[model samples]
Target: MGLLVFGGACLQGVGGLGFSMFCAPIALLLFPELVPGPLLALGCPLALLAGLREFKAIEWGTAGYTLVGRALGAALATAVLQVLSGPTLSVVFALLILGGVALSVQGWVVRVTPAASSAAGVASGLMGTITSAGAPPLAIALQDLQPAPLRATLGCVFFIGSVMSLLALAAAGKTDAHNLLIGVLLLPWMAAGFFASGPLARRMSRTGVRRVLLTLATFSALAVLAQGLLHSQA
Candidate 1:
């Protein structure tokens, strides 16, 4: 688990949003208790570190809009979860993410307007709360930004979203002392990976970042899809 956290943190440090993407699927299969709640808790500090690393580059206006949307989406997800199965929601959102990635590849550039950001945030919140894989929507929406701003803005948005998610999980009785302790114990690994990513982040070009971002987004969607399918089968 420490190794997993370390690796995921390094990926997030370089691309601003991949810790859960990289960790959730494996953890779900092995350390099931470590996911959603504990992973979301760990994400908060990791995102904070990334945001502070490029504080000046954060888009405050976009972040604000995204947060509001995230709150609404989370609320909606909470209500929806009572009605729908998690695997069903996961499959739906995973398809949506893949569609977004496809459009992006086809030259559909999403401008960082208030509506787009907020909408992406809503999707992010819903998917994140259910699947612990929320970054894909927002990452796709902001993929056009320069690397620094992209990383910083995503970091900020994710930080707040993560906190909101933790609260939601706590209210839903998904969080507990054991999971919180797991998150706390993994902090050192997260920190180590974050610091280690500095040199690699500095060396990555804009194109490289975009490629990595898109790839990660696609991987996130696929992983969610697989998870949903497996759960449905079971």
Candidate 2:
């Protein structure tokens, strides 16, 4: 688990949105308790570090709009948890992410306008709340940005979104002491990955970063899909 967290953090450091994408699937399969809550907890500081690394490049306006939508989405997801099974929602959202990825590959440009950012935030909040892998939507929405700004913006958005999701999960009684403890334990690994990412992030071009973002997004959706299927079968 430490190795896994470190690897995911490294990816996120480079791509601005990969920690959950890389870790959530395996965590769900093995450490079921280290998800939506624990992982979200870990994301808070990881995101903060990334945001601070490129603070000057952050798109503050986009972050603001995304946060507003994230709040609403988190609320709705909390309510949905009362009615839906986690595996069921996971399957549904995974398909949605795959669909979004498909459209993006087909030359569909998701402009990072206020409305689009908010929409992405909604999807991100919903997915992040349930699956702990919400970066795909926002990453897709902001793919057109340059590497530094993209990373900075995503970092800011994710830090706040993770906090909101944590609160919502806590209110829904999904988070507990065990999850928090696991998150705390994983911090050192995450930090190692974050620091290691510096050199890689510096070398990546805008195009390279976009490719990494899309590829990771697709992988995350597939991982979630596999997890959902396994859970349903189990």
Candidate 3:
């Protein structure tokens, strides 16, 4: 679990996304207790560190607009949780993630206007709240932005969204003390990953980082698809 958390956090620190996306499905398989709550708890500090590393580059205008859509989307997802079974939601979410990744890889470009930001945020919030795979929408939406700004803005958006998701999970009675404890324990590993990212991120070109990020997203989505398949079989 520590190694997984460290690897995922390293990806998050370098690409500004992938911590939970990369780690959550595996955690669900290995340590079911470290999910939704504990994993989300780990997100707060990890995102903050990643964002702060490139703090000067954050695009506040875009992030602000996205927040509004994220809130609405999260509410809608909560409603979905109430109506859908776990297997159903997992399958649906995994499909959406795969679709999002396909669109990104195809170079589908949506201009980073306020409207686009909001749309991405809504999608991200819905996905993140349910599947812990929120970054793809925002990542696709901001694919054209410079790496520093993109990473910083994404980190901020994720940091805030993580808080909101945790609160919602708590209200839904999905989070508990055990999850929190596990999340807290994982913090050290997360920190280690973040610290290790500095040299690596600095060495990689922006294009390289972007390619790596998209590849990671693709594989993460596949992982989710596998999880959904297992759930359906069960």
Best by TM-score: 1
Two-way lDDT contest, 2 vs 3, winner = 2
lDDT (CA) per prediction: 0.89, 0.87, 0.80
User: Sorted by lDDT, highest first, which candidate order results?
Assistant: 1, 2, 3
Error of 3 at 116 (Å): 1.7
lDDT of 3 by residue, 1-234 (tens): 899989988988788788887888788779887877888899888988878999999999998989888888877888888988656676676676668667766876567999999988888777766666777777667777777888898888888888777787899999888788888888899899989988888887777776767777677767766766787798
- In candidate 1, where is summed lDDT lowest over 10 consecutive residues? 160-169
Give per-residue lDDT, candidate 1, residue 64.
91
Off by over 4 Å in 3: 78-93
- TM-score of model 3 vs. true structure: 0.87
Number of backbone collisions per candidate = 0, 0, 0
Alpha-carbon error at 224 in model 3, in Å?
2.7
lDDT of 2 by residue, 88-142 (tens): 9999988887897888889886878999989988888788777767788887889
Give RMSD to native, each candidate: 1.8, 2.5, 2.4
What are the per-residue Cα lDDT tens digits for candidate 1 across 98-146?
A: 9988888888878889999999889877887788787888878888888
lDDT of 1 at 97: 84
- Mind sharing the TM-score for model 1? 0.92
